[model samples]
Target chain A: MAEFVQLLVSGLATGAIYALAAMGFTLLWQTSQTINFAQGEFVMLPAFIMLSAIKLFGLPLYAAFGVSLLVSALLLGFGFKRLLVDPMIRHGVLPLVIATIALGIFLKEGVKLVYGAEALPFPEALPQGIWRFASVSVTVNDIGVLLLVFAMVLALQGFLSRTTTGRAMQAVAQNPDTARILGIDVPRMITYTFLVNAALVSVAALLITPVYLAKFDNGESIGLIAFIAAIVGGFNQIRGALVGGLLIGVIDNLSGAYISAAYREAFPLLLLIAVILFRPQGLLGRAEERRV
Target chain B: MTRWLLPAAVLAVLIALPHGLKSYGIYLLSLWAVYAMAAMGLNLTLGYAGQVSLAQAAFLGIGAYVSALLTVNGVSFWLALPLAGLVCFAVGILLGFPALRVQHHYLAFVTLGFNALVFLVLRNEEWLTGGTYGVEGIPRPSLLGLPTQSPIGFYYLSLGFLVVLSFALYALLRSPWGRAFAALRENPTRAESLGVDIRAYTLLAFAIGSGVGGLAGAFYAPLVEFIDPTPFDLGTSLALLLMVVVGGSGYFAGPFLGAALVMLLPEWLRFSESLYLLLYALLVMVLMATCPSGLLGLWAQARERLSRRRPPPPVLETRT
Candidate 1:
């Protein structure tokens, strides 16, 4: 029972990170109907930025985190999106998707080329200490991750529901042609989606990297897993994404303990394939009527 | 005369090109041929059949492992190669089942997940696969009394296989099956209305495409004389897709050119490993932009320019 509780806590912590990463993808999908393969690279680059701010610029931890998120949101969310995505969007879906994949490779190698090939250790941001009670123990890192994720989710929910821009964004996602007919600036909404999504992805990276250590390769697998999480949870809904993340986290932890550890990574993929095959609409997603 | 001229011209180049190049160049040429075969498979799926497969590398790995395991166990390379293709064909059909059910883009996840799963199994199933150390000392098949250990011998052998595969693909594409695949790509709903079973044709495309990939992998195993999981990852899968796209996806002769450009361009830019990838990615973007219709489109553009400067000629309505 103690072990199970500990596993559950850790699992939720990791799932929170996945939920954050997946939000970037689902957010973009929600508005623009564009899926960025570069989301992983978004997380990867920001983690490096934060590390460099601490290592090279000698900024304090909180300041570095803030600086990294700002730079990533501006550079990737605004600049790269305008330069690559805006042009490719006109070309059609294949080119846009391929370009994003290319951007991922470019950013990965760009980090390796400029920052050197070393995987840098992230500076500690969360408090270090264990909280134990009656054979059940949770680390401060776990608590910090959970609280930060919850806060971000609530903030996003409030922003999406309460703000004019957020509602407009949802309107665009619901029906782009209709939204445009109603005089909404659909492209700007799409760009805003990218910005918020980038912020959330970076935040996810900032929280998760200290535990796993930041590496160029970290982005690929984590990005893929988060993508699956979004898929299983229903990429259309925020709550579904969270549930998907938590489910994946629990499954990952339980499978690692019970099933063969060597194939733990395979479990998420199997679940993903099964979900895609059996439930393309996802667990929480409602099926749309198809044209005859 | 035109048909004979083109074939004669290509044949002359193929025969003369290997003899003029060094051993390493010949080896690279062989690798290019292998990649061309695989890219053609991808073309049939993504280009013609309109399926998005991110697991091309998985099929390639399956072929490599099957052939490598069989050959290392004293089975003839000739027998193992076909067996590899057959195994991959079955696997492709199996993957196609899920593809039939899911949306095309969502189906990419199925392939991606399958890719990751296959990689794990390849790396972990240590008892049969030889694990991370990889299977080595794969026997190169010989014809008659000649051994393919020599670079020249292997190059010709690979080229022969490529030629056979190309002609076979050419024949297949010219058949009604090819028309069905094209119809599926152009309009799935319309094709379905015309009594074409979308499910079966998509399955056929995946099976044939992946079988070709497996064929290339079988050749790749012997060419490299080693098999490991590293080369058959998402990166290589993307590279294969790049080759097909760059070469000109719908063109029959496109994969050959694309494979050559994709595989050989890096060798020419061997100044820095990282620079090569950056350059290649940039080139793909440029090629994709300049010739949204591909390299053939670029050629057509050049022809248009040349024709414009000359006397007015008959014009064809250009299709987007």
Candidate 2:
């Protein structure tokens, strides 16, 4: 019972990170119908940026984070939009998908060439120590991650429901043409979606990298798992992404502990195939009527 | 006479080309042939049928391992090669089942997940796959009354397979089956209305394409004399996709040209060392950004423009 509680706490912590990463995917899919295949790479790049700022430039942790977040919002966010996504959007989905896959390779190779391929220990961001309740014990780091993720989720919910810009973004997602007719800047909103996605992924990177380590190829696995999470929860709904992330995290942790550790990664993939096969609409998503 | 002239000249070049190259160069050419064969399969599926498959590498890996395991245990390479194709053809049909349920991006995800799953099995099943130690010492097959132990001999063998595969594909594409595939790509509903069996053709597209990919892998196992899970990962799958897209999907000659660019361009850019892949990625990105249809598509575009500028041939008329 105690061990189970410990596993659950850690699972939720990891699940929060996945939720954050999955949010980027759902956001892009929601707003523009663009699936960023390089999303894993997007999450990966900012960790390197933050690490470089701190190690090479001698910036403080908070300042380095700020710089990394800002760079992400610009380069990965706006620059990615203007450079790759915008030009290819005119073509159909295949081209865009191929381009994003190419972008992922470019990012992975670029990082390897520039930053070296070795995994590096990340600087501590959350508090250290353990909390014990009877036979159950949890790391402060896990608690810190859980708290931060919950706060961010609430803040995002509030912004989406309350703010003018947020509502405009939602309108654009609902109907870009109608949004345009109502004088909302659909293009700018799309850009904002990318920016918001970048920011969310960067934050996820910051939280998860310490546990996973900052490696050049980290995106491949991380991106894939988050994709599975989003799909399992529900591809179309924001709430679904969150639920899916947490669920995948817990499932991954429990399976890794009780099942064969070597095959833990395979479990999520199997779940993904099952979900796709039986429930293409996803657990939280409603079925849409198809027109011939 | 003119049509024969082009093919004859091309054949002359293919025959003469290997004799001039050293062992390493010959090996690269053979590798190109193998990859080109795989890309042709991808072309048939993605280009003609318009189904997106991210699992071609999985099929290739399946073929490689099957042939390797069989041959190393004393089975003839000839028998093992076809067996590999058969296995992949069956598996490909199974994969196509999901295509019935999902379309486009959803299908892409399903295939991608399948790829990851296959990769995991290949890596973890240590007792079966040697657990990354990789199977080695695969023998080159001897044809009737001839030996292919030499690099030059093997190159010809690979080339011979490629030629046969090409002719087979060409004939297949010219048949009704080919037209059905094109119809499926253009519009499934319209094709169904026209009495084309969408379900069977969809399965056939995957089966044949994957069968070809498996054949290429059978060649790959002996060509490299070893097998590992590394080359059969997502990277190679993406690289194969790159070959089809960059060469111009749906074009008959696309895979060959695309395979050459993908295989040989890196050799030419070897001076950059570590930066070669980065540079290659940039080039592909720029190409995709400017022209997603690929190199042949560009040629088609230029030809269309030139023809548009040219005056029409004068028509002969009979007196009323």
Candidate 3:
């Protein structure tokens, strides 16, 4: 029983990070109808930024985190508007996809050039201790991550449901033309979505860096996993992202524990293929009428 | 007469060029031929059929490993090559079933996942794939009784394959089936309404593309004399796609030119080392921005303009 509890706690902690990443991905897809292949790089860049701030500038941990989030959000928003979304307005889908992929490659190699393609230890900030109960124990960082994720989720929900801008964003996602007619600036909304999503991803990166260890290439795996989570949950659906992240987290943890660690990454991909084959609409997604 | 003259001259140059170049140049030429073949396969899928596949490398890897294993176990190169194509064809058809049902982005995602999965399998299946170390010591292909170990011998062999494949592909593209693929690309719904079997054509395109990719991989394994997971990663697949796009996807010779330039340009720029990628990225952006029609398209446009300006040949009144 205790072992199961331990697994559940760890799974939820990792799932929270995935959930945060998925939120950013879902937000981008929701507004733009394009998947940012560079989404993972957003997570990776912030962690690197935060680490640099602490190690080089001798900044306080909280200040470093704030600076990282702000810079990441600004950069992502700028790139999306200038490079991807704007060009996509005139070109076809392929160009947009290719552009994002180019951006991803550029970001990846740029980071590698700066960081020397090596993983670095993130400065320890979380309180180091564990709470034990009935042969089961949970670390303080794990608890902190879980609490932080839940708080962000609640705050996001509140913002979306109650705030006027948030409602306008949701309205735009559903029907951009109608929203535009109703006085919502659809392009600006899309840019705002990118900013908010980047902010959320940066927060996830800041919190999870201590657990995963920061690396230039880590974004590829995290972005891939977040993509799988979005697919499993159904693209463009917030609730689906949450459930999908948790489910993938549990499956990943269990598979690593029971199966060989080498096969752990394969599980999510296999699951994605199966879901795509059998349930293209995803677990929680609504089926749309096929055009052809 | 002029068209035939140019083509014949080009072919002669290609055939004789290897004799003058160094061994390294010969190796690079062979590699370019193999990549050109693979890019042509991708063209059928992405260019003609309008489907984006991120699993080209996976198919290539499958072909390489399959042929490598077969030849290393003493199977004839001729036999192993065909077998590799057949395997990839079957896998392609299987992949095509789900692929045809989804939209473009979803299909791309599935292919991306598929590539990742293939890489994972290659890295983990030590018993079969030789694991991360990869399968090495693949035997060089022999034609009839002649050994193909010498660079000169391999160069001719590669050229022969390239000529035969290109002709076959050109004929295939000019066929009714190729027209159907083009029709599907332009408008799937309209094609279906016109009694075209969209599903069947898409499946055929996938199978043929994978078969071509497999064949290229088989040749590549012998040329390089090694098969590793590195060469067949997602990056390779993306690079192939980039070649097709940069070369002008719709043209028959577009992918070949694209592949040749993309592969050879890096070699020519090897002195720059680290700056090569940054320059390449800048070049890609410039090309995409200024010449969306690609290099082949640009040439075609220029030729049309120049010909338009020239006076029509004096009407020689055939009094006789």
Best by lDDT: 2
Q: Give TM-scores for every candidate, taking all chains together and pairing residue i with residue i.
A: 0.94, 0.94, 0.92
- lDDT (Cα, tens digit) per residue for candidate 2, span A189-266: 999989989889889988988888899999998888889988988887777888889988988999999997988988
Cα lDDT for residue A87, candidate 1: 70
The complex in candidate 1 yields a DockQ of 0.44
RMSD of 1: 3.2
- Report the Cα lDDT for residue A61, model 2: 73
DockQ for the candidates, in order: 0.44, 0.46, 0.28
**Candidate 3 lDDT, A123-221, residue by residue in tens:** 665677899986999888778878888889889888887999999988878888889999999888888888888788888788777777888788887
Quote the TM-score that chain A achieves in each candidate.
0.95, 0.96, 0.94
lDDT of 3: 0.80
Candidate 3 ranges beyond 4 A from true positions: A289-292, B1-10, B291-293, B297-320
In model 2, which runs have C-alpha deviations exceeding 4 angstroms? A289-292, B1-8, B309-320
Stronger candidate by TM-score (1 vs 3):
1
Q: Give the alpha carbon lDDT tens digit for every residue of B155-188 in model 2.
A: 9999999989999998998898887766666677
Instruction: Order candidates by lDDT, high to low.
Output: 2, 1, 3
